[model samples]
Target: MVLFLKRMLLASLLFLLAGCGQTAAPALPTKEKAMKVQIEINASVPNKQPTKLTLQRQDLVHKLYTTISALPVVTDPNRPCTMELGPRYTLIFTEADEKTLIEAEAQRYGCRPVIIQGERQQRDTNPEFWKLLDQVLREAAPPATVQKLALLHNGQTALIDSAQQAQALYDALIKLPPVPEGDPHQPEKQSAYQITFFTAHGTLSGTIDKQYARLEGNEQARGGSYYVNDAFMQQVQDISKSAHYAPGRPDALTVTVSGPEISMRSFIDTQSEDAPIMQQLYTKITRLPQKAASCSTEEEKRQKKLTTTSLHFTQWGLPLLSVEIYEGEHCQQVLPGPGSEVQPDDEFWNLLHKLNR
Candidate 1:
């Protein structure tokens, strides 16, 4: 009976030892060297978005490598897997690994593992694409390349000859990253403005969206959209506001004023060499009051309709300035000109009279 008890105790002790020995396997070793790595998660499943994580730090890269390595690899070839809901992972390591450990480790984490071979394959395969893009960058580098820029917004055009603005725009374009192909099924938002880069070599046009820019076409005929950084877009807005009217040589200046029961038009010819007077006229025309007069009664409201005055300055048979003015009901009462009863002691009326004479 003593021997039987001892045997039973020994058997139980052995059983416990066996169970302790079958503990979980240890984690795999990680690569210690620094590496330029990019991990992309491409999900084909609905509502499962794709993500990309780039790592340059040695410690972080090692941690990521080890984490993937620890996962159990899918061994069964017949394992129930479908590409439709694929959570495929692509791991790109700049340094070549003879053992392909990273690829094997990535396989355990996703449906498939893709390894990038070298830098050459990462760029656009077409040689002409590179040449055209490089040419654009070169042509857009110098401020002198752009002679004139036409900015159109809300049916109003402002022609500018600012080198600072042109340089800012071109620099932003050159800094744009390579465009990635967007999902065809996804909808694209409308662009805010269109900028045409006129260089001596040729013309390049593009549209600027909130977060992206679309280059219309290239010499290779490869047109695409690229990501625009926030800093670049902000710079574009800052410089674009520099667009304003600058006085140019003109052949004639025509002024038209229309109000409730009043309409008057006048013209000025530049052949008279009225530079000083014209400058004063330009200043007065642009600085006209824009607010409408207040009226409370029905009769006053009927008489208080806003007045619109336009100054058309033409140069070499072309229109230079198409200035429009919309002022309150008191425009006729306050304006100093042929149609107004109140003639103030300002030179505005005198200049108008001289131009018309």
Candidate 2:
């Protein structure tokens, strides 16, 4: 009987160990999946200045939510001694969750917690918003209607006519979400590029940097400023460069240069089949500087007697390029004709001679 009892005890112990070692069942898929999350971080450190990071991947967002939710809440009546403005983070979630989850997470992380409330809470997931957005994009002009799409920025313009090129741009623009309400507290840098789509419908223009886009009419639309992430902006720029207009028979060419001493205008005929020199002139004039020198005072500028030159390159009646030159205070003007005293013999005059020939 003693041997049987010892054996029974040993068997029980083995069974318990086996049960302890067994793996837990996998968690069931969640019905409340996250559609998007915006994390705003405010840090005292200069390098960590307040910025917002947006995450859209459901799995990663879920993981983040789970990790944050597990942090223990701080219940200190007074501000926690550990808090000294190192960094404060605010998380905005789009899916359904207990309000306590955000509070607990904030307390655990020692950061301020905010839940996007009211209509803003459902901004991304609302079916109506999506429907309206879809309609706006659909009406944003078809690729066929686009005659030329141009990117105008930094006093330069690049034009293209490929339908595929226009479609890529339209695709990028359509992906932008409606701008949120209220002016963001963060300072906005000037737009890096202004894209103008010349379509049969009309001219559609937008000023966009990498992170933000302000469409012409969309600012007053129900949705405020179009928010575009960095990746999308990079893709747009890449497509723009790839679809740059290929030079062919230009319509016309104009070059204008003005300086303290002299102003000159040159027009070249690019429409003629035999006018190869017109293309060369077009290349030279467009390459000129776009802006005039910085003069501190009107009197000083007047004393400089700045000359202005304008050049027009044309094919038939249409002008291809119009060049305007404002001569710098230190620079001198050289005329192309005979008996003209050319002091500063630059490439400008060399190209002018080619055009004159």
Candidate 3:
């Protein structure tokens, strides 16, 4: 009987060990999922300012929520902790409606608990909490400042080199709302100005017409034709008229597509169903930071059994700018035709591929 009891106890212990191995971490309790979160962060040291950010996108909020929810709860009532927290983050979460705002405070120091203030609960998930916060802040932060602004107006172009002016102009320009309905102040001859600015986000372009600059909602800026207040709009116009401005002209585009799935075709478009597409392609090509380079060894030997498209850009009587692209990642390049290799922004290459298809 003694032996049997001992065996029974051993089996029970084994079962409990297996169960413990499969146990998943419990998350902070919440009734509803959040689609957005607001975070405020600051350092414990002096002379620094706290920064506030609101993550409005759903995907980002969900990632942060997963980390927050997985935080292990602290059950010890009298846990010892260091006196001062090194870095602190106050996170406020309220997405789709619960009873009240849920706030969590994350601190760096001994016992490092992430406290959900309302529930009066603490979680021992500081390591992961800080790691995720670091990544999110880096991504959510915008470029420090605008360094250069390039404007294309009426076939004339100007490049603004003053960082201060570019920063001020772009900040103001991006905030203007779309022109309102039925207003009476129309300019006699309004010409559109195409402006491109360079930042950490890569090349971005927008258009300006008289007192309004039309900014398409792209990944960076909210899209709309924002009305540039008179004072600011006049400043841009005056800059365009300066001696630094240079004369230029728009180029015409011709696309020829020959592929297995499609017949030989060509477009000599300036103003038709294909005009906008051609114009956009031409504009993109002119700015591509492209040069000739060979493809990978494997790609070099791959059979060129795909469709080919060629674009020829012309300006009045100037020599034509010609390039050819294969339907697939062909050479992963746009060959400067008559020559075997050249580099074009893969983005531009992809755009043509979709259009040709």
Question: How close is every model to the real structure, measured as TM-score?
Answer: 0.28, 0.33, 0.35
Tell me the tens digit of each residue's lDDT in model 3 across 96-136.
76333468887776677777775555677655566666555
Which lDDT tens digits does candidate 2 get at residues 1-357? 999999999999877755543222223234255555555546556774455455555665665555433322222324433454544445565654532223111211233331222211111112332333233322332223445566654545566677667656665665677555454644255467667655554555666776677554321111125777877788777866665444434555665555554455554454554367666655655555433333333443578665555555433222244544334456544332222323333766666556434
Instruction: State the TM-score for model 2.
Output: 0.33
**Candidates, ranked, lDDT:** 3, 1, 2
Over the stretch 3-76, how does candidate 1's per-residue lDDT look in tens digits?
Answer: 99999999998777554322222344446542645555555558855555554555545644544433332223
Give the winner by TM-score: 3
Which residue pairs show backbone clashes in model 3? 216-223, 217-223
Candidate 1 runs further than 4 Å off: 1-145, 183-189, 220-224, 245-357
**Cα-lDDT of candidate 2:** 0.48
Ranking by TM-score: 3, 2, 1
The model with the greatest lDDT is 3
Higher-scoring candidate on TM-score, 1 or 2: 2
Quantify all predictions' global Cα lDDT against the true fold.
0.50, 0.48, 0.62
